[model samples]
Structures are given as structure tokens and as C-alpha cells.
Target: MSSRASAPTPPPSSPDTGALPMVQPAPSGSSPQGLALGLSAYVIWGLVLPLYVTALAPAGAVEIVVVRIGFSLLFCLVLLAVLRRLGELREALRTPSRWGATALASGLIAVNWLLYALSVVSGNVLQASLGYFMNPLVNVLLGVLLLGERLRRAQWAAVTLAAVAVLGMTVALGAVPWLSLGLAFSFGLYGLVKKRLPTPGHPVTGMTAETLVLTPVFVVGTVLLHGAGQLTTLTEGAGHFWLMAASGVLTAGPLILFSAAARHLSLTTLGLMQYVAPLGQFLVAVLVLGEHMAPARWAGFALIWASLALFTLDQARQARLRRRARRALTGSQAHA
Candidate 1:
């Protein structure tokens, strides 16, 4: 449930090209700064966000998501104006394809946000954390299914392990973990849509457009909730009001930091760093939230962790090979 809201990186294609595509590595002096920013973003998502959502006591999940979207849209617009990026947003939207993609991405992300909020408020933080843990594997599956991408053997094995974990959990729990699957798949599809944007523009701009597309629906819902005496923002006291308003900052701040991190870090580093959020969530769920980890669930999580280890190792090995190849090519060119 942590804000998988970071700017989307395009997924890798078949192994004939490479197992994982490498973005430019962090500049020699900038890696530390990038690491810090990335860590901060993920920590806020994993550690801070669950606690923040739980504090919104009087508000239900729907209301929280509504307020989040509205405030997030407002915050994003202000950012566009202040950064003078409104024109860029306009240009991106001018393309019909981009607008459609943005709209779809908006819907997908809203589902993800709503599901995450529901999970946190319902004492299902452990499930939410599991979803995020499953997300990267879900992304790889999505790449293969939707993007016609081929997976390496290690990737396939990792994916199979994740599948086995899910199946085991379903059998043990006597019901499918639909919440976790919904969260994983929705965010994965959202990333896919964002990656497909013909004109992705700036991360903030894309966020603004997505929110703008959905703001009207949320606005109508807010009005309906108020009429039904369900909207609690104002009557819930000044503390609640501020917390509700702060959703905007909580939503957008990490996104900006993530975008900055992406600029300085290689895709490999960023990919590995993504686990920080889920790991934090896992700790918070068990320690702070006091969610029980049944033995079956523990086994499921162990499988997932093992799968992620395999996936990460494969990617790291590929990245090292790429770097060495680049170095050799540079040396040869210099000698020639």
C-alpha cells in the first residue's frame, strides 16, 4: 500500500536485448544523495503512511481516498503553477493517446490507493505489505503477458516461486488473498499504463493530469458524502482537518523525491531500493500494528523473500556484466 506512486520506469523486454535494462548509473559523487532520497521516499511510504492512515479514525477508507485524491490534485496543480510546468502538462494532454493513458492510469492508481487505505484501516497491514512484496514479481509477469517480453530462467523461477507462495496461502487461509492480489495487480497495471504514456512529461505533471482526470468524480462523491453526513473533515476537530489536508503533502512529497532519485540512480539500484518500503511495512505490521503472523503466512513470506532474492541477484549479475562490457568498449575505443 505504500505509494508505488513513484514515476514509472519502462519495463524490460526479452533477454535477447538484456535480462534487465540498465539506466545510467548514479554519477560518481551523487549516489549517496540519491540513496538518501530514495530511502526517505520509501520509508515514508512503508513506515509513515500506515500510521498516518490509521490516525484518520473518523474517516472511512472511501472518504480517505476521496480526500487524498482531491488534496493531491490541488497540491499537484499548485506545483505545476509554481514550477511553471502547466504548459508542459497541457502539451502532454494535447495528445489524445496520452490523455487516454493518463485517465486509465488515474483509475488504476485510485483503486490501488483505496485498497491500500482499506487494508490499513481494517487491520490488514500484513496483507498490504505482502502485496507490495509480491509487486515486483507481478510486474515481471505483467511484462511477459502484456508487453510480450520474455523472462530469463531465473526470472521464471522467481515468478514460479511467487505463484507457489500465493497458492499455498490460499490453501492455508481457505480463501484467496484477493486484497493482496488486487493491490499488486492494480499498481502493476498502473505502472504499465504510465510507462506507455506517449508523452510522460514530468512526474509531477503526470500526477497532476491523472488527478485532474479523476477530480470531478471525487468532487461529486465528496458532495454526496457530505449530504449523507459521512464526510468528517470539518466536524472531526482541527487535528483531523489538518491531517486530512496533509494527505496532499504526504501523497506528493515522496513522489517528487522519487523522481529526483531516479535521475541520479541506476535502474538496478532503484530496483533493489524498492524493497525498502515493503520491508518497512512488514516490520511495522508485525511490531507496531501487532498483526499476527501465522505459520503458514510465515512460510508464504519466506518463499516470497527467496524469490525476490533470486530476482535481485540475477538483475545485479546482469548489471555488472553490462558495466564491464561498457568499460571494455571504452578502453578499446581509447586505444584505437
Candidate 2:
């Protein structure tokens, strides 16, 4: 999942969505502590996660996803109890509308996790990286389509460039990049649903509610897998079992770090840092995994990178303009 920032008060950062709640503006400057936390989180998400997924060898993607959800719920419950915030989880469950929304978000994130796990296990980490790289643009497009948000000229141009890049890849590969698109759209929609939540509970509480909503289904599925002798957790040896169990901490730890980072860094800094995960994935795919990138594929990635450049430049420019306006207003008031 990617860490994203929004206008005004950011939402609480979720494990999957990573958006800070929109209750207050983030700090305008970056602190060393925030940078360290943000970098650690992104690195783990980008570099460590694929390796971790690969390490879960004999286990299939479905089984891995099931275990991840089960363990993640346990982790969230422990976190809530320690923080004395179990009441928040209960309140969310008590409200029908909140529960329903959490359920929908739960489903979306489950799909995202399954897809990501499948990609990593199948050695398609490059495509997974591309999907995340495209995610911010996807968010922008979704905002325009679903939220009636307007895109500035540069943003429109950047989106058009991304579209062309996708078209080029499709033509070169002789098929759609379904894995890439699937990851992008699934997580994008997950973020959208979280944004539309009725109350926007604390990230940990929200995660608990989401996992609680899905726990029964996953538990039943786990039992069925074990009945068929497909479950690998116990049979995979103590090492693998422990690794599988560690999924919960891996899932929630980075998110908490990211949420803390958001409190100390500006959105612009966070926006730039968000790319660290995808870039790490890309490096891992090429350098570590030795995935061959054909000339056409390289060209496509170049175009996408160029599009991101335009998008980032435009955002920085807009932020500068806003800051200047604010400064001018302050100066005029002081003179009066």
C-alpha cells in the first residue's frame, strides 16, 4: 500500500490506505525523525515485503493471504487493547453504516493483498511496482471521476502521458497489463472507500473493525484449506510458521511509523517519499530478481517517470503559489 496525503485535515493512516485523517494540517517542514520513520516504512514496504513474500515458499498466495488477515487481526486487537482504544472498535461495530463501510473497505484491501501476494510469488514484482507507481495518478483520475474534482492543465497532461504509456505497453506486450492495472485500481478504490467513511475512526480501530468483519470468512476458509491438506503454516517447519505469523506485525508496523511521520513532515515531503517504495520494488525486480526489461518496457517506464516528473513539478508549483499568497496576506494584515 502507498502513503498518501490530502487537503486540510488528513485521515488516520491505515495499513492498506496509509492516508492520514483530515483533522489538522501536517507540519510544513520535514524533521530528521520524520524522515527516518518515513524512509523505514517505505523501505520495508518496497524492499522487505517482496523478499518476505518470496520466503513464504511452499505456501500458495491464497493461504498466505488468509494467514495474513488472521494474524493481522490478532495484532490489531493487541494494539487496541494496549492503547485502551477497544471502545472505538466496539463503537464502529455498533453502528450499522460504519460496519458496512468498513466491510467494503475490508473487501477491497483483501483483494489488493491477494493480488500483491500473487504477483510476488509468481515473480511479477516489476509489474507490481509499476502498478504502485501508477497508483497516485489513478487516485487523481478517480478523484476527478468519482469526486468531481478538477485537474489542472499540467495534471491533465500528466494523465494523458500515463495513458499513452499504458497504451504503448499494451501494444508491445500484445495484451493488457492486468496485474499492474488490478493492483492500481484495487488499492485506488480501497483508498476511495476509506476516504468516504462515515466517521473515519482511528486507523488501528478501523483496521480492527475491517479485519473483524472479514475474520469469520477467513477462519472458515482456513479450516477448509486444512481439511484439504493445503494449509502450510504448521507443516512448513518452525521457521516458516514464525514467518507466517509475523505478517501481522509487518502489516501494521509500517503504517504506524508512517502515521507518526505524517505528523512531522509536510505533504510535499511525504509525496516525494511515497515513491521510495515503488522505486525499491523496481530495483529489486531488475537487480535482485533479474527480471528482464525489454527495450519497449524500459521505454514505457521512462514515459511513466516523465509523467510523474510533470505531476510533481506541478504540485510543487501550486504549493509555492499558495504559500506566497498566505505570506502576502499575513504581511498586509501586519502592516494594517
Candidate 3:
């Protein structure tokens, strides 16, 4: 919920691929717990971020991001120790290729967090929602362009509709929605690189490694910001200081929750839950934040929502077909 909205990597197949593969369902033993944790994480991300924007007032986005990175690394280190996973971190460090990959991923995620913080600080939470809403579609394009994945007709139509929506938004705002686009693309690419990394299931270790890579820069930058009178956490009194310090938990808690959820939920269920964050952001922007949405902007949002409907339906249909096929094959082989 810290606006470091994490996207799990896209499947090797485009989500819009005509023949979507079956995603395994959650194990019964853990489904309830996973659903609870995942929902909590998503809700915090979507709803709590706006509040943090207010709390982080007087602190520029860059300073907040620096604190977030520094404290998150500390939190991750603690979790690693408690979980007895320091060996995983050591193993990752020993591999030179992983070092490079994690370094790159660190930069990408930091960029993502910075951009998201900037949008929120600028009172553009509505745009942030739009960006996340466009994220899955962006992943489709990334898969096609980067991974040589093919998109079916439905997928193409969805992308086209999204384009039209972007055009509408541009007209409504008298400029392009760069903040939205930046968030979508940055997070999309982050997920892509993280997927290719050697780290498999150790989210804590992987994140710790990435943050460790960024720690020095953030540490030095914080000092420079303080010297320049740009940093505000200390002068802001105990209340503000604690809130700033809480960035560690704000940044790391949801990730741990998400990792727990991933182990016990189907990709489909998780996909559905993914929208909760954006939807909450959208509501907060309009209702609580009082960001006005002109008719044109509303029309654009409606179109994007429609496009998502088509995309989700296509994915569901393909998954069902794959499941039936697998069942039939299994039955025939059993008889044989």
C-alpha cells in the first residue's frame, strides 16, 4: 500500500493469449488465510496511500522514497533473520549475475515508488488508479514486444479501447496523462525483470537484496537533503517522525502479506483481487480526495473498464477450455 504497488510477473503466455493455460487453484489448507492477508494488503495499498500522502506532507516525494527504501531494507533484514533465511541472501550475493539483475530490478522498483509518490503528492490519485488499471494491458504489450508472445483478437481490441481511453483523457486534461503511463510502464517492466531474476520464491531475500543495492544512494541522498533543508522528518515533531519511521512497515508488510497469498491462491483469484487496489484508489480520489472528473474523463474510465471486462472474460473462457481439455486427456489415458 505504500504506492510501491507491486505486480507479480506476467505469465510466459500473454494473459490475452487465445489459449490461456490453466492456473492451479489454492490449496484448501491455506486458502482462507491467504485470501484474508492478500485482501488486507490490497486494501491498505489502495486506501491507505492517500492518507499517507497527507501524513507525509512537507516531505517531498524523493525524501519519502529515500526513507521508505532505507527503512524497508531494515525491516526486510529483520524478517530474514527471524525466518532464518540469511543463507538465501548470502547465496544470492555470491552469484555475480544475480547481483547485476537485482541491481537493475532495484532501480526499476525505486523508479516505480518515486513516480507513484510524485503522483499522490501532486493530488493525482485518480491518474494513479488509471495507471494501475492499464497495467495488465501494458503487460500484454510488454509480453508481445519483449517475449515474442502473441495476442489474440480480443486482446488487440482491448488495447485499442485503452488507446481510445487515453486519447479521451488527454483531451479532457488538455495534455497527456504521463503520470499514469509512467506508473504502468515502470511497474510492468519491474515485474518483467524480477521474473527473470534467479530468485524464485524468496520475496523477502530478493527484496532485501534489491534494497541493499539502493541503501547507499538513499543514505547519502538523505544526508544531502537534510543539509539542503529539504528533509522534514526530524523537525516535524514526534507524531510526524513516527509516521515517517512507519514507512518501513508500510513498505514491507504488504509484500509479506502478498507473498503469503501467492502460496495459497490461484492466479485467477489473485488477478481478480488485483483490481481492489485500483478501485479503492479511484473511489478515494473522487469521494475523499474530491478530485473532479469531468465527463470526458469519466467516459475514458468507462471505456477502460469495458476493455478490462472483455479481457477478463476471454481469459476465463480460455482457462475453462484448458481445464476441460486436461480432464478429458486424463480420463482417456486412465481408460487406456
Candidate 4:
């Protein structure tokens, strides 16, 4: 599909009282390319598990995030220049509230990343993958609670299945898989926070602000370490340096993909497809990386998948019903 010259006017920062209710702009229709790009972003993210574990082992999680965020900011600068979105960048920054909310998102995301990286490096990759598997259900709960979205009969059944799945996993493990759960919940909440924020020029602008929130700690931490000759950059291993740079680019690239994809796909479809990352991550963790799993663990994963299938089917049904309702309303108005 051809790109529109200008994006729709964004959502207002604050809603008014006793006036017309505000609506956030919906994504473009049937943008296959955008969906594909979004999936690809997660796909890249999913497939990089082993690399992240290996790359981050030497330096540590905080250091990795420091490098990732700083370099990612640089990467975004270059991309912004290439896309000629500097004007957009300027606007996003000018809106102090946008940047402030973005800074909050950044803090949330940083916590999520730290949890995930720690999980991966500490041989809990499989568990981390499981947390992501459960995340969609969490999002659904958020929709109901936070967005006032409702579920139909099938949707409710899906929720029940997801609960059972999480229960099964907890039972099988003899302990809650907290690392995975923490990552899932934190990241899902990050999305929610970002969702509530006014639309900025680019999705990454939030990440920029997020990074800014931690910049002082990140900078001072790295410097203090470097002063003691503890910085990984001093290792003189070209491979480590390259991975550090790649991490920065990798961090921002898929976000760019998803943002572009967001321009084209409906929110529901995008939300559903967001699972691709975890699926890819799960496969890589189990098959390629050879993360150990017991039969019970397998059972847990199976239940989770079963729950997701139920949820996904329900979502499809709702979409169909919505479409039919829309058509009926149009037809009735035409006859009148």
C-alpha cells in the first residue's frame, strides 16, 4: 500500500470535561507489510536469545543496558535523520508531558529488560519464554480492567483456560516462575503506559525518554566501573565491541518495524501477532539452545499454548461479530 503523506492528527494530551470524548487513532487497515515488519521485529528479538546470553555474560545486565540504551539513542538519531523525522523529534521533545510519560515508560521497560537479561544469562531462558507466553492473557486482563474492553462468552472461556495454564505451570514447577512472570507483567504494563500516552512523532521517542530516566545512573555506573578498569569496553575483544554496537541497533530496529507496522494494522491484530516473539524465543530456547525442560514443564507449556489457542479463537469470533454489527448498522441507516 502507498504511504500517506501525513499521519492522522494525534490524540490530545489531556481529555476535556463535559465535552466530546476523545478517541485514539486506529491503525491503518490490512497493512500486511506493516504486520510483517512488526512480526519481523519480534522475530529478530526472539531469535537473538543465545546471542544476548553469550554477549551479556561477561559485562553484566546493567552494563549491557547502559551500552544498549546509549548506543540505541545514537541509532535513533541516525534513523531519525534518515527518515527526516527530526521535526517530529523536536515536537515530541517540546511536549514536556509526552517526554515525561515516555521517561516513565523507559523506567518500566528498563526493569523488564533487566529481568529478562538476568533470566537468560542465569539459565532460566525457558522460564523467561514462558512468562512471555502468558503475557497476552495479561494484556487481555488489562483491556478489561484498564481500557474497559469487554469479553464475549468465548473470550471468557479463553480467560479461564489461561488461568488454568498458569496454575498448571505453577503446580508443575513447585514454585511460581517469578522471573518469567515478572518480565511479562512489567513489559505488558509498559505497553499499557505507552498506550495511555499521547501519540508522539515516533514510537521510539518514548524509549529515548525512558533511557533519559536512567541516564544518570547508567552514566555514573559505567564511569565508576571504567575508572576501576572494570568496563567491558576495555576488554579489547573486537567481538564484544561489535556486539555492544549491534545491541544498540538491534534494540531500536524492531521498534521501528513495529511502529511502521502500527501505521497499517488494527490494534487487535497487532496485539495478537505480538506473540510471535515469544514463540520464536521458545523454539530457540528449547531446540537451538537446548534449555532443559522436564515433562511437567512441558505440560505447563502445553497448557499455556492450549489457553492461547482458546483466547485467539475467541478474539477472531469477536472481530467477526464486530464486523457484522458494523455492516448491520450501515444497512439499517441506508434503509432509513
Specify the highest-lDDT model's number: 2
> Which digits, one per residue and each the tens of the lDDT, describe model 1 over residues 167-257?
9999998989888899888887777666565635466777777778888878898999999999999788999999999988888787777
The sequence of per-residue lDDT tens digits that candidate 4 reaches over residues 1-336 is 122111111121110000011232253365668768767766776776445655555877667766776777777667667877767766766777876766666677777777877777776777777778777777666667776666656556666776776677788768888887787677667766766775353455545545555667678878987887768865858887887777766777666666666667665666576577777778877887788888878887887788778766766665676789999999999999
TM-score for each predicted model, relative to the true structure? 0.90, 0.93, 0.90, 0.82
Q: In model 3, what are the clashing residue pairs, if there are any?
A: 1-45
Leading candidate by TM-score: 2
Against the unseen true structure, what C-alpha lDDT does each candidate score? 0.78, 0.81, 0.77, 0.65
Show where candidate 2 strays beyond 4 Å. Answer: 1-25
Clashes of each: 0, 10, 1, 1
Position 200, candidate 3: lDDT: 30
Candidate 1 error regions (>4 Å): 1-30
Ranking, lDDT, top scorer first: 2, 1, 3, 4
Q: What RMSD, rounded to one decimal, does every model reach?
A: 6.3, 4.0, 6.4, 7.9
Candidate rank order under TM-score: 2, 3, 1, 4
lDDT of 3 at 219: 87
Look at candidate 3 and tell me the lDDT of residue 197: 62
The sequence of per-residue lDDT tens digits that candidate 2 reaches over residues 287-322 is 999998988789889989999899888888878878
